[model samples]
Target: MIEALIVGAGVSGLSCGIRLREAGIAAQIWARDMPARSTSSVAAAVWYPYKAYPEHLVIGWARTTYDELMVLRHDPASGIHVRNGHEIFPWQVDEPWWSGAVPSYRRITPAELPAGYRDGYVFEAPVIEMPIYLDYLRQRFEALGGTIEPRTLASLDQALGASDLVVHCSGLGARLLAADSTVFPIRGQIVRVTQVALDTFVLDDYGPSGMAYIVPRSSDCILGGTADEGMEDMAPDLSTAEAIQARCRALEPRLGAAVVLEHKVGLRPGRPTVRLEREQLAGGKLLIHNYGHGGAGVTLSWGCAADVARLIAQA
Candidate 1:
């Protein structure tokens, strides 16, 4: 089997490892901390195909990941669910954003909208509990005889010498590791409440300058948060947390009672466009660059992985 070394163990790294195994390639992921210990866990894992990606792949990637997770939903081992919900708001239904792709995706007739919502559409999409989902990917990787190495790499050259190929799934780490000044960090903050009710998801475009949303996971209610802002360090900012909660509480009542299980944060490795390029290194190392999904990492994970793996195969 062809052996590959994958750097950075986020969803991209994990998903890429899983796909490589399916293609009969042996893959190992090396990271300072495991995938779940960081950004992958902080996401309110919404699989929405939004403006975050190019039209050719954005919606299509979310659609493909949804289909794959559905087949596994029946298996108790698979920690995924088909979460049905709506993208809601008041005064913003003009030129509705979620009209075409999701099933039963029609606007609630005037009589159907809740009192507070001016109007909105109900649509069904898969919401993943990222904690379990991350673990599941790790299991699938090992089941296929893949390896995961957990360590803080001081240099990319360390892995460069031993492997036939190196995939940088390092997320924000690439800013230094690959000398990629293009990859800066978008800070996202979220509150996981030990509180939840209701079976679906809620997205309120009302960002206080507000793009607020609430996603339910099995253990904790994942409520969030967003940004169009970039910060250099990967630290959670308090004012940002307050702003997200204030918006979310105004939108959803249950989460309003939120007893914080954890206030989590992550630096989403962001670029104007996601880079899925391949490079031959200074010493002739084969590198597949697959970072920069911004906030849509889970939504685009597997599909992006397929593209990354295809490029690596050709390289």
Candidate 2:
């Protein structure tokens, strides 16, 4: 009967908690903020593998997570919606590197391309409403008899003696707590608007204007975003929000009349590559590092969690 303490209550920590508990380990989470307040809540979390590194491993983790999300979509309470979407490119391109992960991936014909786009691929991907989905995860983790508490730690050593194992899913907090200076912030800003009768999502990662995407949920459409590398400011910039809305509206004219609902800014935990390995400290305790997901935190959550559980089993 091994007990584990996971630091961070965001999607990664919650997902790891669920997997560990299902594997018969007693897992509890401690974090500075709840799911709703964590950076994961601010993501325009459509399942596209963007901004994580070490391409091969990221694709593997993304594929596993895509399948998991697809299964979760069957449960109405999971807040996972499989929406038809296309990622358009400004120039001609071949099939995406992650196309195999998508069950229904296909290249769209020229007739389906938006003006000025030369190539695109369409697929059914999960568009998650973070607020609802985070709550769903929290509830699911709790129903498994796992506990989450509000706590702030000055260092990773603080969690060492409380449990047999400590898993770090602390996101950006890892930069300081784990003393891993490679971790930095990739700031993103997004705008939420009324749904505007849109069903499909549109993503233009390499558009001339910047990284523009429209992710429509059941109630609101999430329009974004900017990937400003090395930016840590969390305050939503009014000009940036306006630019995001403008770019989204250019891509989808129907959004022109959509009223603004809210503006959000989040600092994504960025690193050269995701850190998902284990370390042994003094006193025979185990510490597993699982942060620095950058913009793919939600995209990589389940896959990373499964790997974490496997590591625990082998311990």
Candidate 3:
């Protein structure tokens, strides 16, 4: 029986573990931190392709993920929901390359535009409650005969020695393990507030006001954030939190004095482009690299995992 080992247990690794097992390969995930404790959990986790490139491949992967997420959204236990939201733009622009992936996408009318936005679009997309969704993925992986081990890897060579095929989903850990200098950290911070009676998410990441988004889950809403490139500090800046709250309130006046729940900081795995290719090593061992997804780790999770499984089969 061929066995495979997947490093890192964030959304990417867990998704790959599930798919590999479904492909009739025995696979296990070994991670330094559990999925819930990883950066994937800290994400607002709405399904939008952000900060990932080259546009050609990313659109395909994002479309695949969108279709899969739509199926998962029907299952309440999956912590996935197709919520209506808007992505605001400061200037008139054509629809995004991945706009076709969304089932319901349309330009916002002149009346719908916010105070300073020239154009916008409204669409329904999957919004994942990270904590619950991580658990859902974990349960699904175990049910599919995949296993999770609490282990840390020192280098890719160590993983290659143990299994016939090794999948590297190590996120930012790739900087040290894969010796890829291009992989760095894009630090982000978010503030979680008490649940508001709102289902619509709002994103205004561009323009002079800086990055900001409001994502509502079942129990609470996430107000965010800051994208500080090359910063790895995991401490949530309270000032940033205040700024985020103020901006979100300005976007939607209904967020009046909502109680602050928690502040979170995560170091997003930043890279010029996502790496999802295979490398062959001595002794007939293979290493499939699938990390550096940046903020799209959740957005591209399922599609990337499916592709990784295909790579394993071809190897």
Candidate 4:
């Protein structure tokens, strides 16, 4: 039997741990932080493929993840909700490249467009409550006989002695762990607020404010955000949070009175493209790289994990 050691306890690593255990492989996760404290916890977590590349692979992975999330949505405790939403544009545009991945995707009529938007698409996508969802995933992974230890690795080589395989899901830590210079941070800031009687999400990727989105969950709503490339500060900015609320309120007036809950900042692991390939270590152990998911980490989690399991099985 092969045992796998996975790095990172974010969505990607947890998802991979579950898949590997399901595939009859013993898996353990070691990470610098637990799921609740990882960067994934800061995501607004709507199921749209954002900031991931190589269109063909991203579409496939996104579609697969969509299917998985749809299944999980059936369980009330999963923190997954399939909600109606709009992705409005400031100018007339064709359907999105990821339109096919969504089962309920359709161009909204001009009458449905919000003020100041010329085109939009309405779709039903999963809006994940990251806090609850991460807890759910942690429980599910542990239920499957997998364990997650809080440990930080100085390099990929540190885990090779304990397992036949090391699966790298380190996200931005890949820059140092995998020695991949292409991995950089796409800084994002979001403000969480009390649910403002808003059930539907509103996304304005090309709006005047730039990349604003409203993701409503079971309890609260997540309003976000900024995509400042190469920005690395994890500290939440007061002005940025104010700007985010202002942009979200412009989209949905009800948010104007929404009570503020908390503010968060996360560094999305941006890369030219997601790295999901295998490598041979010096001692005949296998190393699988599975990082640099950018903003689509949750959107691509299960799909990438399934592929990672396949690679280990074949090896």
Tell me how far the alpha carbon of residue 68 in candidate 2 is from the true structure, in angstroms, after superposition: 1.1
Question: For candidate 3, lDDT tens digit of each residue in 141-193?
Answer: 99998888888778987777779799999999999899999998999899999
TM-score of 2: 0.98
lDDT of 2 by residue, 222-293 (tens): 999998888988889999999898889889999998999999999999999999998877778999999988
lDDT of 4 by residue, 1-315 (tens): 337899999999999999988888889999999999999999989998999987899999999999999999998888999999988998889778999998898888888887889988999999998888999999999999999998888898787777769999999999989888999999999999999778899888888877799999888999999999999998999998999988888889899889999999999999999999998777679999999898999999999999998888787
lDDT of each: 0.74, 0.91, 0.89, 0.91
TM-score of 3: 0.97
Instruction: Mark the regions of model 2 whose C-alpha exceeds 4 Å error after superposition.
Output: none
lDDT by residue (180-260, candidate 1, tens digit) is: 887777777787777566577888766434777788766677777766556655566778878777777776666676687
lDDT-wise, the better of 2 and 3 is 2
**Model 3 pairs in collision:** none
Local error of candidate 4 at residue 286 (angstroms): 0.5
TM-score of each: 0.87, 0.98, 0.97, 0.98
Those runs of model 4 whose alpha carbons end farther than 4 Å from true positions after fitting are none
